[model samples]
Target chain A: MDYTFQFGVIAKHLPYLIGGAWLSLLLAFLAFWAGAVIGLLGAMGKTFGGRVLYRVIDVYVVFFTNTPALVQIYVIFYGLPDLGIVLSPFNSVLLGLTLNCGAYLTEIQRAGFQSVRREELEAAETLGMSLWQTVRYVIAPHIAKTLYAPLSNFYIWIVLGSSMAGIFAVEELTGRAINVSSSTFRTIEVFTYTAGIYVVLTVVASALLALIGRHAFRVKARIF
Target chain B: MIERIVDEIPRFFTWYNTIFFLQAMGVTLALTLIGCGLGSIFGFALVYGRQTRGRLFTPVRVLIVGYVEIFRRIPFLVLLFIVLFTTEGFGVRVSFFGIALIAICVISTAYISEIIRAGFEAIHRNQWDAAEAMNFGRVATLRYVIMPQAWKVILPPAFAYFVMFIKDTALASQMGVLELTRVAKIFNDRGYSAFLTFGTCLLLYFILSYPLTRFGQRLERRLASSRNR
Candidate 1:
């Protein structure tokens, strides 16, 4: 337990690590929005489409949700080359994460969809509201209120989850930490600093998300 | 590509390979179960420590809160590396499995403590007051009053987390743990088709996790119904 603390060396690379943190956020942001689109379609299909469509969406959700994201990325990154379709490490990881997030978001969004009461929709129609107006004024607010907390939580999860991109040699926060630690032989200090950055990064992200949720949707989501 | 995978299918699913995968699957299951089983106990202790009332225990409570907050925010991969390097720096010899297990336990304790806290909060304050009126000590109150009600709320989400950890333990592969994902990588490195190796790896994970997930959902539904009743 007599190891020396050498924060000085790692401190010099703080800017490099911060740059990697931005890349991590960027990765999570892109994948989350892309996944949200896929999730919305899956949720809509599950809720409103026929039995066949429901079963197909169910299978997709079940398979993706059950399997590990790392393996999914491996398949896309390594296996796809066999079929003459090569993607960069970043693209493969992005594709894998989007598909995985889509499955979980489908389940979350489906719950939100079901939370919309039939009577409320009927009341909106009775007020001579057109379909677009009904969706805009009535359905959107109800869905947003119910879904905001879970969606924000899921975003934070994705931010943490994007650390896996480092495995594929993508220069995200964890990857750069690996690089710095290897070069300086300061594995412990580098990783401890990386962990601290993750904590601060996620906390700030959570507070900002809570603020957005409060202003945009009036949902009282917690920052902590 | 399809034909190549098809050709490798029979070769890949040999008796030796099946045995290799099953053993690796067992490691995966053991890691999750043991790590989380320990985590639940430690998590309950953390919740209990945080619930203590007194100026003397204030630092203890603050430390508990800080531990849970900081650990929950770090990614599992970072935590794994930190644990690995910290142990090495201390000149302590630990197996990769041991390192992974420690990492899993740390993260799960943070998460499950929150779940346990929520479960305890779900119980009415009157229950605590009622126990106090009977002169029951804190341990007796938790044992006789709170736990009987709180476990119903805790079990489902805790089980869901357990199922989620099955997939997460895949990251242990990066440290060469010979778990399911590591085994898959070995096969792929042996020049097996990635589709055959990693795809099978994915299916094996699904087999391990899907049933537990379904059971957790059912447990939630049944518990909700019973709670209503």
Candidate 2:
């Protein structure tokens, strides 16, 4: 019954833990940007591409959304080698998360596109805007405005889900926690601190997003 | 391409023992059901405890808030690591399945509680007052006045969440549960084709999850139609 708590054990290891946190944030950051691009393209394809492209986009969206991100990661990480395209753990995890995020964001952005009015599209057309120009000048800003809140939510989801990078031994926050726990055998201390840092990261980033959303985009980004 | 596809079919089936897949499916179902089932019970307890402004329940309310806040904010993988490792370090011998099952239940409770509480919040304040006027006990009020409306709101999304949690079962495979993902990994270790092994794994998961996806969509449509009246 005498379980002495050792707060001291993990104190000096704080820097390593934070370094891992930084990696988690970095991975999510990179994946989000990459995914945003893919999503923009995929959404465009679904919205404007012919039937063939629409069906291709649909398959990607349905499969990626339904399956676990981990399995998707496994397929790209393992299955790609079968096709002679080998990716490093960093590349594999990044690619997998990006593809998954792309699928979700494609749907999110498609909703944004649907919300764009015909008058706006016609106005852009009257101004001699090319298709790309119309999308960039007309559709993009509106999507940013309407989609900011949901995108912020997805950003936090990515932050948490990126913890799976640890499973691949990617030396992220969860990976470092596993390392420290096994080394010090202070399982509770290590993971408690790790989990605390994750919360702090998610909260701080979400608050920043909410603020940007409220002030810059006028979206009601009411995140707790 | 036809020949390649045909070759892959046999390579895929080489690892396909109906019993093996069934066993993995069984564990996956067990994890999802136990987690969602007990989680809903405990989550309802949390919700009901929080609703009571009784002096005795104040600490419980605070505890419930803190529990949901922590578990919801933090990722489940970290919680699983904490539980699996902490229990092991303390020399509390248990199977990884036991540890993973508890972790999933605890983690899912936070999410399920949040969704349920959203349903709880949608009930009008006057409804509760009416229940009080009718001399309903707390349990009776929740059962009769509150939950029916909440269930109408909660059932569709809650079922979707359960489908999501079924996929989450694969995460427990890292803790060494022989779930579908882990089974595929085992076969991959035996020098089989990764495409066929994990590809079949993907197919099995698709088969398992696709119907739930349809059901969730149907529930939403049904709820929307029923609401319009």
Candidate 3:
């Protein structure tokens, strides 16, 4: 078990690796924000919309939740071009991640929606609040309170899941590491460095989310 | 394009081709089963270690926590790549199937441990004393008293984790394993559209995953109702 560890090649590629990490973070951030919108709407639809809307959202959640996000990415990135709607690798990965994240977030946010009290909603209405206002002022606060922890975890999930984009040549964190490793044949150093970046990404993101939740949403969600 | 779906796709559904697909699914199921089986046992060990709180258990708890934190924090794909690529030069001669399975097992063990630990926490501390008073040994108490109850909480999500493992196996397609996703890749490599091939492939996955997910939900409801009664 005598193997020399080489940090030279990896050190040389540090800027490239950081670029990849930034891309991964960028993809995760976009997906999280977009997924949140989709999830919020889906939750609202299931809670109060017509039966058709409810059923549609239900199917979306089921299909996405049941399938692998990687498969979905493959399909979206590769399949849609046949129908004359081609997307670049970056667009494909983002679209893939946003839709998949939307499905899971729908389920998570629905749980938050279900936990809101019926009387509180009525009270909002009595105070002359419109539907959006009722949701914005009353339901949003309640859901945000409960959703902080799960959303924090979901955010981390997106960051990690974004690594799959590397396979499609997006050159995100993992992809960049693989390129350096394969080119340099410094598999141990490159991958170890990449994996370390991932750990730092998750840990730092968790702490940032906790602080955001405390200040913005007043949810005392623990980072651990 | 519609012609591709309606006609060209059917030619690929012959028994020989279907067998490849089935074999791939079989590999996936094997990965899931092996991962779940070994992962659960090891996860139970973690929770068992976690049940202790003295300075003597500090090292054990530290080791377990360190493992869970590292594995769980990292994406399974990254872990898979790390294991599949790094270990080969170290004289670990695991086959691609073995590599994929072990990677899944290692990652799954981390999550399963947390799940079982939470289940253990749900049980009352008084229950431990009750088992002690009844003259039950540690292993006996665990087998009879703790696991029987913990499993009621563990089994449903554990099944869902099975679904998750099935999905995770798809990532191993990059490792050259002939799983469903790789089978889809093989079809696509034949000048077929990756989208159409993997689209059909994902449907097959939906078929596999949808049932397990629904059943997990049903089991969760059953547990809830049975408890209420």
Candidate 4:
């Protein structure tokens, strides 16, 4: 319990920590965007595609949702080399996170899509819209309206979950903090500073998302 | 090179290693159970505090919100490292188990409180009015009427949270606690078989959590059917 609170050591590592934070943010942003694409496709597949596609998406969601993301990262980072397809630490972690985020996003977006009333879809169809157009002009916008808050939360989740990437020596904020802690033995200071950075990053991310939602997805005034 | 490594798996599972693994599982489970128990108690307090809006309501609200934000915002590994080692600053010694339990409770309480609040919100105002019309005392109404229903509604979410709590306990390993994952990490470091070690840890977590997942699903289904009726 004899721990030193050495701010100097941590101060020296602040640049590294910030760099790590940037990389972590990059990882989350890439995963979020990639996952959104995967999500849109998977949602469509699950909701409207043939039975085989639906079942495949169902299993994908189940497997990813049921397992811990940490375990998935470990498996991807460590197990892939055995099969002769080795990945860099960064790619392995990114691949694990993107796939995992994609699964959860698929479920969330599917729920949003399902919530789009049948009447609205029919209205779009009656206007001579093609299947793709109907989905684009009708279902996608409707789902986006209902999904902003949950999507924001999911973004925060991936940000937080990215902390696990440090385990694979991806050198994110937590990893940098650990290195500082080991060298300086200032465990408390190192982690506290890192956690503060995390809090700031997430709060900023959430604010940005909220503003985007307000500007991009605002609809006509609600009677309620 | 790979053959030499693959050939040593059987020898790694010595009697001592197997015993340590089982003991580590026990530690992990114990920490999870203790955390969940404390979390439930604090969680209920939070939900009630939020609902009642009594004299303590504003402070309680602020406290709960702050608690939830701080824990949820912070990474689990950071919290684990701090709590596991920071006690001497207060001139008191705390064991690793104590720190792990406290960290889990602190984190889980926020989630459990939200789940409990959701349960409370799910109860219709009409149901509350009906209970009041029956001349039930506040205690009796909560115990016999509101609670049973809320408890049922919260079970699926609470059970899911419990599984999360179990999995999170693995992070205690970073603090040098002899938990399942830590033991696996040790074995992996020594054996240089990261695949086997992490793979085993993954399997252990699945073995522990999958049953809870099934139970939660069943409870959710039952709740859905009853609600429909």
Highest DockQ against the true fold, candidate: 1
- TM-score per candidate, chains pooled: 0.98, 0.90, 0.93, 0.84
> What docking tier does model 2 reach?
medium
Model 2, B1-229: lDDT tens digits are 2355467566556444657977888898888888888998888888877887878878888999898877877888888888886777677887988988899889888988888998888888999999999999999998888987778788887888898888888889888998898888887787766776777788878878888888898998888678521
Show the lowest summed lDDT stretch of 10 residues, model 3 chain A.
A1-10
Compose the digit string of candidate 3's lDDT tens values, residues B82-168: 788767757678899888878888888899998888777777899889999999988888888887787787777788888877887
lDDT tens readout by residue for model 4, B1-229: 3574577677767799889888988888888898988998998887766655567568877777777666777777777767765774545677777888888888788778888878877888887889889998767877887888888788888987887677778778766778878888888778556677777777777777778778888888888678522
Q: Alpha-carbon error at B39 in model 1, in Å? A: 0.7
Q: Write the per-residue lDDT of candidate 2 for residues A25-121, one digit (tens) a residue.
A: 9999999989999999999999999999999999998898878888888888877887889998878999999999999999999888888999999
TM-score order, best first, reads 1, 3, 2, 4
lDDT of each: 0.94, 0.86, 0.86, 0.79
Clash pairs for candidate 2: none
lDDT of 3 by residue, A14-113 (tens): 8899889999999999999999999989988998899999999999999998888888888888788888898999999999999988999999999998
DockQ agreement of candidate 2 with the native complex = 0.56
What TM value does model 3 have? 0.93
Q: Summarize candidate 1's per-residue lDDT along A101-136 as a digit string, tens digits.
A: 999999999999998999999999899999999999
**In model 2, how large is the Cα lDDT of residue A219?**
79
Candidate 2 vs candidate 4: the DockQ winner is 2
Task: Give the clashing pairs for model 4.
Answer: none
Candidates 1 and 3 compared: the better one by TM-score is 1
